[model samples]
Target chain A: MRERRIIAIASGKGGTGKTTIAVNLAAVMEGPVAYVDCDVEEPNGHIFLKPAITAANSVAIPVPIVDKEKCTGCARCVTACRYNALACVKGRVLVFTELCHGCGGCMLACPEHAISECDHEIGVVETGRANDICFVQGRLKIGVAMSPPLIRAAKAASPSEGTVILDAPPGTSCPVIAAVKDSDFVVLVTEPTPFGLHDLTLAVDTVRQIGIPFGVVVNRCDIGDDRVTDYCQREEIPILIEIPDDRRIAEAYSRGCMAVESLPDVRPFFLQLDLRIRDLLSAPNGVQSAT
Target chain B: MKELVVVSGKGGTGKTSIVAAFAALTPSKVLADCDVDAADLHLVLQPEIRSRNEFRSGHEAVIRQDACIGCGACLVNCRFDAIRTVSNADLAWMFGAGIHACNDCDVCVRSCPLRSLDMINAMREASGEARKTAFVVDPISCEGCGVCVDICPVKAISFPERVSGEWFISDTRHGPMVHARLGIAADNSGKLVSLVRQQARQLAQDQNKEFILVDGPPGIGCPVIASLTGASLVLIVTEPTLSGQHDLQRVAELARHFRIPAVVGVNKWDLNPDMTDAIEAAAVTLDATPVGRIRYDRAVTAAQVAGKSVLEYSNNGVADDIRNVWAAVSALMQLDKPKANREAP
Candidate 1:
């Protein structure tokens, strides 16, 4: 049996080639692999992978639906809610579905049993296949404020026993945390510039707090200075791979083409990356630093 | 004051770079970096910190282990599954048992006929003591909803405000700038973004600046919404890619939903000119004006690496493109006319 590993490619700063690395890595992997795009707000993996849609599942969360007939306008639900999802306007209860976290606190607090739960569609989870690899992505409904639930739905649709590569959203906030957490290993892709180094440190802090083993992969390594590599060495974090600033790769990416499939020169880099990840995971100490 | 916000629905289509260039071009402006999660405009503007303030919002539950009576109230009521149970033996291993001096009497130790001291020491060393479970709150999972704090039977849980991030007021070469940094793994960035915008408005009022230029975050989510809600105008910077077009439509819809006028600028338009034309056409249908197109330029990155805006680095190529975009945006904003003249007589 092949060892199952869930790897997340994440970059705190936007436009650092996170999806580029994720799709190319999936293209180079052998056998049955799963690719999950957790960047629900702006998912780009579909543009590169061009997966054929086999199924689409609408992801919804439970929001409070008030039964006015059973009502005593006690305002308990409004007071109990921490998110300001419920309001008492002119002795009537108003539900702001967008503000609700869907925690069901309002339902639990309703003394008159007036609050009931209803499914509120926030996004859709689409499942399909791109060649031998199973592909899943979350598309958040336009104007939806929350994306973590949709991201979770996409991850849940992924095959449990396989090599799963999750392309995480940029930033170190809740959405990024939801996408990257629970992965066996994480690949932090970054450029070597000041913006990249700054955001990389925040991402490192996030993954370290989650207690996940991670390594760095610097994209466009030749474009910026060597501070990123120097920082990794000082922190004892492994530098898995460095992809040079290649115009061909950028052109391929802009045209919605996978680099591994379009550029022969890029294939070797991704293949080598796969080998390094497997070797590191199988090592005794793994890639986790002492800090 | 009239406000202009620059947003990119997709990540890294050169929103910050353009905003920095606009800051350099426009003199009577207050700048704000509303991308609190991974703020990078400060890198280009090189703001000198004038004041830094902590941003606190919401509350997370904290359990007092000493007061907890091993009740399951909080664990059962938490909807987020943020509560966790750990055996007392495990806690003792991690954090030592509160075994101080029992008044130095040693009566219990001496009274046992089986030599309880040896047994007690052995149990502590081997972590084999009888286990009593204690509850704890996982900070990440806790939505700071206060449900656990309210449901605890023994009132052992205390809800305290969370220090989500920090906001800063700073001085730059061009003007005063407002920005923030959301704490690692913290929530409520939308709130922080709003606070930063508010501060920028206040600073602009104080300094008598007529314009406020805001660099908004990527994605059409909470922080992005917060940045552009009441702004006078919004300029969406996007690239010539399928993903970029898809995200641009959503963000343009967001601006329209909020009733804010929007304009679009295609960055790296030379990478895929066909897609650029398609995106501009789509932007028009979405009621967004296509203002300008910027060719793919390495000088943008070069200028970023040198910590200078492209306009400041050189006045050719992308710099000229940015100047054209700014001119169109300002014309839409009617900034060439004095504020008093534009007002109703």
Candidate 2:
């Protein structure tokens, strides 16, 4: 059996073309492929892929429910909670569901056995398909604080047997970690500008710390100076493919069109990217697959 | 003091660049870099650290090696897959002599039939790896539910706070700036952003500054919400891309939901003029004033490379556009001053 790889397209900075790379790769790849958009806070892959929703699952976190009838408010649960999700005021345990991490610590801390968990839905994961590509995305309900759980749920929905392409959220934080963790290889998308290089370096550190083999693809490669290229060369990080600053690409992207479909000539770039990732996966060491 | 938080629902939409430009344009104001995750404003602002403090937000679980009986209770109960049984060889390789630390789920303590497993202080025990393979907490994955704490039968489990990140008060050319860095995979960025904002506001008050400009993170998550809360105005920088339009609507709606007025500016607007117009129309529909449209200029990147704001790098059309936008923003804020004061009582 051929090895099935999960490739997470991520960037430390937002709007660095992670979704662009992810959606385009999914579009160009042949055979079985799954695209999971874990950027729950602002999932935009759907706009580009236009996946039709076939199923929807609500993702929830368990928050402590105080049984008032069982009634001895010792505030033990409150003391055990680190998130300040539970507070005891005047013998009343106010359960702040939004603040809860759903760690179930409060339930275990409750000596009276009065605390039980109830599900608080934070977001939803929708599964669908765009042409031959299997698609899934997590969408956090506005004003929801927690996203890692939802991102996990969305990621879990991807088919395990296929090549899974994950579109990660921006930032070098927990949410990005959650989205990109456990991937076989990470494609760190970045721009060639100073901000891009700075954030790209951070993303590289994160992927390196997570012990994953990864490479970089510089978007708008023609626009920014060679700083990103210089840094990548200095650090011995492979520059996989560079997407030039093209106005038509941006226009097509603005209309919610994937580059593979809008710019047929660009198909080879994504194809080469796919081959590069596959080559890296098949290599004994992923770090040396840059060429 | 009034707060103007610059955010983009999408990343790389020129929020930090614009914030840096604004910092250059507006002197003698407190600046806060609330995008604790992937904070890059410091790269441009070049703030010299004045004061630094550790941010110990949450707890991770640790196990005492001498107390651990080698039971697999923690390994089984860890929902985060943070706990794992290390082979003797790997343990030998990692620590010359010491037991592994256990993450504080406390399940092993409760499930230990021999009553040998005990919870140790997460911060202290984890730091001092006494038992190389005995107890361990994967700090990145531990959600701090305290489940293991309750389940510990030997009463060995104890939760200790871990330093998640650091926040700093710094001196910049613009003035005092507040910023923070979240520990790798650390949670509670919203809290950290809140802390930085709190400090920025306090500094503004102390300094008698008129503005508290914030460089907010991309996306409408907890940190973004924290950045937007109680702000006088929100300027959303967006690009002329499809995702940009979609994200702008989402963030604009978020600002509207919070009853905080938002203004929109399209960066790299020349990338797609039609899309820019469409975004402007959408912004109007969302009640977000389309304040400015910056053409796709190489000068922006050149300015960034020069470690200078576009305004300082070039006295060009793009810089003029940024200045015009600031003018509109200041004027809009001036009109809002009375309403804010009226509501203060």
Candidate 3:
């Protein structure tokens, strides 16, 4: 059986080409591959991949629906709620569905059995196909504050037996963690500028604490200084690929086209990146070999 | 005072760069970087830290090893799966030797002559009362909800307030700035962003400044909402791409939901002029004023590399475009000034 790998491309700072990398890598790979867009807040992988929507499912979380007729306003549910999603005022319990994390603590604490779980749709998960690669994306409903649950839903809908390329949301917050956790490997995409290096350090710290094996891919390598490479070298992290600053690639991306299909020159880099990832994962000690 | 928050639903749409330019353009304003996760405005403004304060929020559960009877209560009750039980030998490798094996009982350490050095083997042969396993919390996974502390049967869990991040009040070359850095992998960024904005507002009011220029985080989530809520105006920076257009509509929708007037600017509009036009038209339908468009200029990257805003680096090309956008935004802000004051009361 071929070794199935879950590779997540993440950058702490936004717009360092996480979606670009994930789509291109999936586009170039020969075997069965799946692309999961876990950036529920934005989700740009579909723009580049142009996936055909095969199925769509609404993702909802359980929010407390209080029964006023139950006759007891003990306020125990409010006290048990840690998210401040519930409040007792004027002898009535008000439930703020948006603030609820769906932890079910309020329901358990309701002495009168007044609280019941109701599904609140936070986002939608879409499953489809973009050419030979399977596609899954989470689109958060506007005005929705929570995204981690939707990200997890998107990941759950992804194909389990294949090379899963997860394009994580920017920032080292709960959403990013939800997308990248349990992955076999992570590709930390970054530019070489000060902003890039600064956020890269945070991303490195996050993946390190998660205990995931990872490497770096420096996009627009020629524009910024050598600081990113220097930092990576000092940290003994592998530089899987260095893509120079190219206008053609940017223009291709702006037109919603895959770089591998639009620009022949960009194909080899992603192909090489795929091989490097396979080599690192197949090694006895993936972390040591990546270094 | 008026607050003008610059936000982008998609990451890397040049929110910080535009904020930096706005800070340089406006003299009597306080700057705030509400993007606590990846705060890069300070890189351009070059702020000098005047005051730094720790940002503490919520609580994390810490189990007292001696009080725990290896009952797995915490592991079973923890909804976040933050608690993990490790063998005595693995625990020794994780925390190292100097620390006490059990703070209260001290049975494991007292039986071993080498303190905790030989505590693993000693624990194995020690009385059955000694715990063979210890529960530890993963700081990242623990949501600081205190559920584990409430559920601990033996009262072994101690809930301590967590220092999630830090906020800084600094003096920039342009004006007084308020910024923050969220602790690595820490939650509660929305709270931290709100703190930065509140401090900036207070600073602006104290200094009698007329404007508070805020650089907001990407996405239309909690942190972004925290940055823009109750603000006088919001300028959404977008690019000329399908993804950019898609994200702009969502962010603009959020702004409309909050009843905040929005202005839009297209960055790198020359990359795809057709998409730029389409986005501007969409912005109009979304009730956002299309201020202006910035041409695709490599000089923007050059300015970033020089650690300066485009306006500070040179007064031409992209700088001129940004200046025009600023003028349009300022006009819109002025038109809504009376409305803002009326809404406040």
Candidate 4:
């Protein structure tokens, strides 16, 4: 049995059609496909996919709870905490849970064994279906500072035996990294504007640093100038597809309709993308060498 | 100075474009681009950098080879897989494995009997490991946690500030602009944003600027939270798409959570009028004012490509709509001076 290939759709800038590509590709793919929305801060893939959630699990991080009776006011945990999340007030230890990264380093530093971890809910991981496609998404609770943990939970919900497509959050940050990690290939969706070009470079740098094969998909190709194409050509980054600007497509998107469903012309593009991705993965040299 | 931050919970909704236009319109205003992670305002504003400062945030660990014996205690205690044993046999050890994953825990230095490991500088990597064996910390992956510092028996590890990224103050055609670039995959963007905002506010006050317009980062995360805190008003730019509508609600909720006044405006509102109305209704429910909407326009990208604001590049309805939107926003915030009483810039 072969391991399932995971293709991550990411963008350094937001609204570059990362979710559009992820949802439409999943809809048009040949085999059993799992569409994972790892943009926990605003998981929008479900809007296009319109998945009926079958199950949901609360995602939590282990934040330390102090036993005042057992603590000796040693202040070891406060000194050990690097995030400034813990402090000793007079005779008691105070924990600022929002600042905690859930690294569990404080638990090891306590000499009196007074610290115990408790589940602190940050979000939810939901599993569902969009027709024949398996759907999963993470929703971060309002006012939550962290998102990587929830993204990890969403990625974990991927089916073990199918093609998995992860729709990543914008920006080249922790949440984006968590979504694209361990993926077989990264499809970076971007436009041709300066913002898109600048962010595409960053996204490319991030994927290269993470040592993953990736290609670019230009969205809104008709609106912006040709600098993105020039940049990709100069950088030797492969251009997978160019999605032209179409009012019908944008209108469908605004109405929460899949492109493959509303615009027949859009189906072939994603279908071709599905094939192109398969071809890239099966090639001996991988995506970078394919160019 | 009254600060107005322009943000979008979702990315690519013209927050920077709107901010850039605002910068061009305001005569006595300083601009701060707080979207450190993927900052794009600089592309449009094309600022001439007057000052550049290294933004040092987290800490990275280092090992002193001169005082060290080769021990694997650090490798075992590292939870983040940041440490590795370096030997002459593998001269490529620095680039080979676990090179950039240090979390700044000084456990190996503490556990070492001879106390060979010292946390020197968080961002700087040590060189000249030709003869001696030592433990190396991968700076990229280090979270600056002090666990290793706590466990080191020899107390060899030292916490040195790591340069996470760089920030700049620059002169643009519009005014003085502040911006930053977070290093690839580096953390502390929220901290960097706060720093940028601080500098912009200080500059505004020093210059007697009437307004400080902020271009905020995307997502309702740490950086976004930091950008919105203490702002006079938040203008959330969004589209008419379902995702845009959904994200507008989340960002509105965040504004409510932070007790910041928010106004919502849909860019390209004509693409889906129904969704536009829906989003406006949703904004009203969240106690956010439904600001005027802007029509879809290609002038935005054309202006970006030409390195100019929409007001400078086009005279279309989209540009007119933006001006009207600004007027409405100014009126809402009571930032507008009476027409006859205002002095021309």
Candidate 5:
């Protein structure tokens, strides 16, 4: 089996064309590729390719359950919980399940060994395909809250194979952190605007904090501010590709078509971006691929 | 007093523009930007921070590694597996901070024969603070329960039931205006937003002002719910991109969710006419009035560059749309014609 090289496409600023690059890059890759759209809060990768979901399963996280029969009510469980999940209220112990983070603190805290673990629905992981590319997507139910667990689930469901691409969520928050955590390399898609640069700085800080190798892709190259390029230069981050601002590209996006799919001429651009990504990966001891 | 938040499910959809424009039509109003994660309203609204503070998220326990005597007592006392032979203060960093929130659990300190474990303030950063009043839960730290929220525990940081943004009472050419800047990532934005409105209401009452305007946050979350809770009226600003239509329906649905009357202002309507119409229709479905449409203006972009609001910039084809939208919103609020549309960017 070929090693699955995970490529996470992330940008702190939304609408900066992260998904645009993710879908098309997969379409242009050689061999069998698996795409994981980990932007659970708002997964739009499927919107472009409109993947017909072949399999989907609800993802759940573990929550603790106290077996009162084994209870000593020592209150150690209450004190051990960091999430404020277990509480001693007046004469009775109260467990607010929503507040639970399920770190197994309370389970070990019980001297009587009363606490057991239960499953709580956190989100759903979806498996599907777009064209010849095998795809996995995570959909966080609105108002259900939390996207990181689903992001992890989607990554876990990824098919082992050729280049794997992950479409990350906007912003350098926890979900973004989770989506890009174990990737081989990260491609930050951005535009040449002050807003984009400001957010790109945050994303750069995040990738650095997590200790990952990354490069920059400036979408809509000619529009807005030039501060993005200046920062990339100052930071010593490599600029891989610069796709110019064109109305035809926007039109294709509006019609729910991939840039490479609609404009086959631009297919070369994705190919080049992919080649550069591979070259960067093979160059160093950093970010060993999780084959 | 009513609190109103402006949010879009999608990003860069002009949520702030509509709020700034709304500030033009009202008598006296305070604004709060709750998107602490990617706050850019200051680029246009020009918030002058009166004060700032350090926001500490959690506690860090450091071990005096050389204290000797590995009695294994600290491990026994530590309910969390955070303490180990290799890592003294914590073998498991993910362990409970319950030591302080810890109900007199001296098990760690007392049980530690080596006396190496010491609990100290962990992660602290200098953050922005202001108080016209808006408590914005830090977007980076704010998470609904069940999703393990990464937070600071040094001080066991819990926000005030009411933390407000720095209050701004300024004189604009149009009328008296109010606004504020929230710290990098505070919480209880709903409460702080209500403070802005209450302050605005008080200012209006003191001055016998006829209106109280507000600039709200984006999206339909708790903050958005708070933004529309008791507002007399709302004006939703949106772009004409595909995401614009998608977000407009969601935001309008949120406004209707809280029973706040809302009006519409389509910023950069010329970017996508068909999408703009779709937004109008969506607003109608939510019973929100489609007030007016603004064309895509390079002037609006230039205005941000000059550090000024569009109203303060050249009154060209786009400014008319802003003026018209202001009129429609005021009319919906059962008011007279707006005297002037003033802005400070």
Candidate 6:
């Protein structure tokens, strides 16, 4: 009866372990969990889960279609477009669907009322279940330049159930924005190198801007420098868990398994991480975790 | 111009690291950070910005309250659910939700019986600021996509080119770094990335440098696509983890999409050798050579703390991996193979 807590794993910097945490945490959630890989351009959670494909669908964005018979070649649509996607060249309107943001400016501007809305397939959305965990992913149709539309589609596929973990796209770009929207908590994972620390700072900044409750999980703790820890401490950010550098764990991961999957003992650590996050989200004061 | 993007689908997979390393390893590669929201390569490369530009997106609605009347018609046609009726104050304060979220079609201005509402070119929130620096470029991605330039019921979204900034030429230790910084929140950043890389190419040609390393932004979005065009090779830096494996596959597949040769380097390989080996196996499937397997070494962190490349750091195990990586890179690019002299572009 309670609202299923939604936790999003996002990083402004890619390769910061957002999906790693998402799939593993979902795999270990005590309650039924739904995992959505919002990184449609490159959905990787399926790689780890190897889910059976239940349904595969394409995501389309609305684009303007010019009815050649109706078009007067007046250049109204071309002039109306701010993106230059629609251009009247040599007395004909040329539409670059990839460049089109589907603003419908040209459709409304046509003197002949020639333009109508058409659907352009941007990518494919895959829906399936693996290991008893519901899963959905988006694969941008080959050469589909835009991703936010697809990311939005995958998020729309949420199971509306117990708990949901969204594995977000990397970086604080539009795709990242699309992935993290409407999530209850965000888990930012990073290593302890300068590269990690630098990117962690950016990811934390992005989460803060999105106005979400988030914490840090420093993986490969022993290998990298302490700058990440020092940054977290200075920023007053909570350090959820420090996953030490261990080769065996690495080997397990390389074999297409979550370290927690191969080693059930780490499940307790994830559980603890989840508890801390829940507490942070439920804090009466709604305090922002300080750095 | 050839674009050699650096990408690893997995989060925290060293995509940026190898990009930065490549920037350092090569002398003339142009650089573009497609990850506008959370750009970090500048932290390592230290590109000096030269220009700043504003990136305007769609228009937000603004209600000009000077005339009068609180009619409900303005509230009826709004599709975005943006308009709200507040207690009647002086006409201005009453309709005071600025255009931050408004679509500005002047629908409210027309619908109001008293003609109290007015919709101008309502400026929406800016995407972000940009600064074009030497060796680095920061293009703020305007969150607004100018979509609201449509049925504002109010005609709110304004498609305007507010002056964001200009390009910059900076000097880096590696060589001349070509970069740009757009005024924060500008749209069409992928094109701007193309512009920066174009400059990098020009600079590399002028210098006759053999390499142009680039640190590509994350995800397979527009900027990533721009970063991938026409590159002789791609070096995908990845980690050995569930996410890393997933990202590696995607980036590899992405490289395949571009039909460019890809090379893989698993950073912190020792931390997850089995994963590292598996990644190597995947790289083989990708048909790109697995250049080097970097160990998870404390020295890497120390080197970063010291503000130096791993190659420039103490000759640690990680450094050896870097050396081996460079050696393999030479082999892949045929940089070491003897060749007949050719005309310069």
- Model 6 ranges off by over 4 Å: A288-291, B1-4, B19-37, B46-147, B150-168, B180-189, B205-210, B238-246, B261-298, B327-345
Ranking by TM-score: 3, 1, 2, 4, 6, 5
Q: Between prediction 3 and prediction 5, which has the larger lDDT?
A: 3
A88-158 in candidate 3: lDDT tens per residue? 99889998888888866676566687888889999999999998999999999988888888998999998
Q: Candidate 6 falls in which docking quality class?
A: acceptable
**Predictions' DockQ, in order:** 0.61, 0.64, 0.57, 0.64, 0.18, 0.39
Where is model 3 more than 4 Å wrong at Cα?
A1-3, A284-286, A289-291, B69-73, B87-134, B341-345
Q: Please give, for residues A181-259, the per-residue lDDT of candidate 5 as tens digits.
A: 7788999998876567767887887787677899999998887767888888887788889998887787677656788
RMSD (CA, Å), candidate 1 to true, equals: 7.6
Q: List the residue pairs that clash in candidate 1.
A: none
B111-162 per-residue lDDT for model 4 (tens digits): 4434433323311154232324467777655667766555554455777888
Candidate 5 docking classification: incorrect
Q: Model 2 - which docking category?
A: medium
- What TM-score does each of the candidates earn? 0.90, 0.90, 0.91, 0.88, 0.71, 0.79
Off by over 4 Å in 4: B61-141, B152-159, B335-345
Which CAPRI category fits model 4? medium
DockQ-better candidate, 1 vs 6 = 1
Count steric clashes of candidate 1. Answer: 0
lDDT of 1 by residue, B1-345 (tens): 788999989988999989999999898989999999999999998999999999998999999987764435466667677888876434233223232322333332432334546554543353323225767999988888887666554567899999999999999998999999998899898999999999998998899998899999998878888998878889999999887898899899998887788899999999989999999999999999999999888888889889999889988988889999999999888853323232231
Top model by lDDT, which number? 1
TM-score of chain B of each: 0.84, 0.82, 0.86, 0.80, 0.61, 0.67
* DockQ leaderboard ranking: 2, 4, 1, 3, 6, 5
Candidate 6 has a DockQ of: 0.39
lDDT of candidate 3 over B1-345, digit per residue (tens): 788899989999888888888888888999999999989998898889999999998778888877665545456556666887776535443223222223343333323324454454444444244445678998877876665665554577888898989999999889899999998888888999999998998898899998889999999988998999899889999999888998999999999998888889999998889999999999999999899999888777778889999898888988999999999988877786524643352
Error of 1 at A106 (Å): 1.6
TM-score of 2: 0.90
**Model 4 CA RMSD to the hidden true structure, in angstroms:** 6.9
Stronger candidate by lDDT (3 vs 6): 3
Better of 3 and 5 by DockQ: 3
Q: Write the per-residue lDDT of candidate 2 for residues A148-228, one digit (tens) a residue.
A: 999999988999787999999998888998999988889999998778888888888888878888999999898878989
